[model samples]
Target chain A: MELPQKYSEQELVWLLKQRNEQAYSYLYDHYSGALFSIILSIVKEEELATDVLQEVFIKIWRQISLYDTTKGRLYTWMLNVARNTSIDAIRSKGVKNSRQNQELTENVYEQAGSAEMKTDAIGLRKLVHTLKDEWKILIELSYFEGYTQDEMAKMLNIPLGTVKTRLRSGLAALSKIIKP
Target chain B: MNTQEYIESGIIETYVLGMTDAIESAELEQYCREYPDIKLAVTAFEATLEQHALLNPINPPSTIKVQLFESLKDEFVHPVFMSAPTKQSAKVFDIKPFLKYIAAASIILLVISGAMNLYLYTKLSNSSAQYQAILVEKTSLQANNQLIQAKALDLFNSMQMMTDPNMLKVSMPGMPGKEKNYATIFWDTKSKDVYILPNKLPQPTLGKQYQLWAMVDGKAVDAGMIGDCAGLCKMKNIPSATMFAVTLEKKGGSSIPTITEMYLAGKVS
Candidate 1:
């Protein structure tokens, strides 16, 4: 399908604040893909991810007024909201129980299976594989899983400094693969 | 301070990943304002991370959009009725009674003139209330019209800026972890005028403000202090500038920009 006409970030934000329905529709059409991917990366379950995506858009509509452009871009703010909402969904008892019953060792991306792997996903998996296990795990937990540095440190039984260094190195390595 | 060592310290990367604690993030923003190199490193790292996130876009099922719009239908419709003038005036002016009073007054003008006057007074008060409702609606409509006109003008100006060949567009992406943060600078070199396109920057702390700097000959010249983070803002014109940057400073701006507090900058090409 053809994409909606592109709007500059400022214009899109202004239109949103004005409660323009077209802008909202455009926002959903353009951003739902990336946002759904982010939510799925964190929540793992397709059903739960769909629910979280719905909640995220509702929150965006209700709270678009609270979005201060000075603070960040619309997408960045929306991404944070999506990540937080997805994390909250995962924390619920039903999701947690299902997650535990599944393979505890499989990360969300791997559990998604190879059928879903398009060229982009293939590239991402390849880039991720190029990193050391320590770096890869850190990237997965922090970036995809939405774990904070302190949380990653505690979860991995490592010092905060190691988490920081490893995250930097991991990103630096991934940067090379993606950019090169 | 050794900026290279600081960049190598991996703090910029950590910040870009959104892993930094609040205090650490605030400190990094301060350093970015004071040092250009640190700010540049942060911007580069942020760009890389943003790229990484963009790689795995997956379209959600099409059914979701239909479901979402259906759910929001009430929200859009309900607000219109709520804000609309309640149709209470419809019951206020019962035309039968009004016509009866007028007909009765035409005959026996002397006998019932006093009673008629009393009845007319009551009718006048009722109509006044109806008139008040109409007046309020008129004012609101006027205000809405004005708002629409203003928005149209803003869009027109933005379009003009985009199409004008004399205007040089500079993309000033946010520093470090603020990769999503950005502002555009439109320089009409022929006119020597600079305009900042509305952008997202973190709101400065109380008693602090963002100042624009035009870098010429390695010296930072104060362009102006930005007042609003929204809408297009005109900044002080310079004969020429090789690069442009923004810095957080004391409320009114400082004589020289705090290099470490620099939020964004771009070289003019």
Candidate 2:
């Protein structure tokens, strides 16, 4: 669906605060695709990703007043919400058990590769493939997986400083690919 | 710590990725405000990351949006459903006769007020529509008044110029073929300004206009085109002129007057 040109980002936010349904619909139509992909990346299950997406949007609507423009762009704040909510869904007991059972039957890397393939043949997949495994893993963990530096350090059996450096190098490589 | 080194430390990247803890993120935010370069770096990093994230879009099922909006509609209509109330035993209290009378009276009052509200609302809407119509009429009248005021100001200025002692009024009687056509030139000799009050010139045919000329030293210099011949039109000024004339010319006035088309001519004394 074509996004409405009726309201700008600030105006849309103001309308959303006033609980305007059309503004909410516009926000959903414009941002839901990327937000859904982010959620799917972390949860790794379509059903759970859908549930988490619904919850994320509800949270966005409910807590919209808390969003401050000085902090960042609205999309960036929504991205954070999606990432955190997806992480929370994965960490929940029911989802954790299901994810662990699935992990036992399939190789994690293979699953990730398949999920990457499931995405449309956009340039992002090609760009992601160009990164070395270490950089890709760091990006996936911090960006898609919503892992903190300390958690990533423990998860990867690396030091906290190493985790930060790897994340920096990963983003630098990604940035170069994005622009160049 | 060197700010450049601090930037190169990957803290901004981590911040963009949302990997930094609360305290570390706060410190980075402070540093970004303190250093312009750091802030720029952070903004660039955030933009790059945001673009990268957006590029991998996967559209959600279309039905989800409909279902979501439907749920939202329910919440809007019955907000009490949002928070589930715990079940408790119902308490029973007997109604007193005086309280019953108060309730009955309040219901009757509510009906009366509701009727009054409906009546007032209809009256208000009717009055507001009439007010809007009046406002539109007022605007139209104001526009017409401005046009009349402008014309009056022009006429007043022309009268003042006509009565000036330094002004010389020359009457150009019609030439032989056009005996009924006449035009008047009000020349301010001191200021070297010329104006024409076209009294009897017929409307020019399509693709034609009346051009006024100042005849100086036997040469007819192009004065100006009288676009609409009915008004007091200001024509071109010449330092000194022996005669003034009017001739029919093409849509745009020519450099030299068409002498054969001359309708009126008068010599200056």
lDDT of each: 0.74, 0.76
Candidate 1 lDDT over B65-123, as tens digits, reads: 99998998666532332344355343243234357677577556645765976798789
Give the per-residue lDDT of model 2 (tens digit) for B117-200. 789879977987787788677777877875775576467457667877788999999999899999899888888888899999
Q: Residue B69 in candidate 2 has what lDDT?
A: 86
Best prediction by DockQ: 1
The weakest ten consecutive residues by lDDT in model 1 chain B span: B88-97
Best by TM-score: 1
lDDT of 1 by residue, A1-180 (tens): 122366788878876776767778998987888788878766666788888999999999989989886444566678778877877786574466657777664554343222222324332444665678888777766665566888777777799988888887777666667563
The residue pairs in collision within model 2 are none
Runs in model 1 with CA error above 4 Å? A1-4, A93-126, B40-48, B51-55, B75-269
